[model samples]
Target: MSRAEANTNSPKRERIKRKKQQQGRKDHVEVCALIPVFLVSRARNLLYSHLMNSR
Candidate 1:
């Protein structure tokens, strides 16, 4: 491998790494946001099922 090739590739690789990190963070935040919604829906379903059974 040539020094110039490594030099050119390193900056591009660094940029891609930064972009990937940002995307990962965004995905994590989306998952965090959805957790409460998921829990609420799950709880609602369980409540409805229990009420139906009690009827």
Candidate 2:
């Protein structure tokens, strides 16, 4: 309610916001990294299946 209390809470709120942003960015990076791996593996599996079917 008071300005001093607001000022104290602002820093804590900012820290929490920053932590959440960092975590979101970290998750985004992990998902981005995994997508290519998943695509490669999926492509490999499809290719293997096609080759087996052709044989």
Best by TM-score: 2
Q: What is the lDDT for 3 in model 2?
A: 93
lDDT of 1 at 35: 100
Instruction: Please list the Cα RMSD from the true structure of every candidate, rounded to 1 decimal place.
Output: 2.2, 1.5
For all candidates in order, the CA lDDT equals 0.99, 0.99
Instruction: Give the alpha carbon lDDT tens digit for every residue of 1-55 in model 1.
Output: 6999999999999999999999999999999999999999999999999999999
Writing each residue's lDDT as its tens digit, candidate 2 over 2-54 gives 99999999999999999999999999999999999999999999999999999
Model 1, runs deviating above 4 Å = 1-7
Q: Give the CA lDDT, 0 to 100, for residue 39 in model 2.
A: 100
Clashing pairs in 1: none
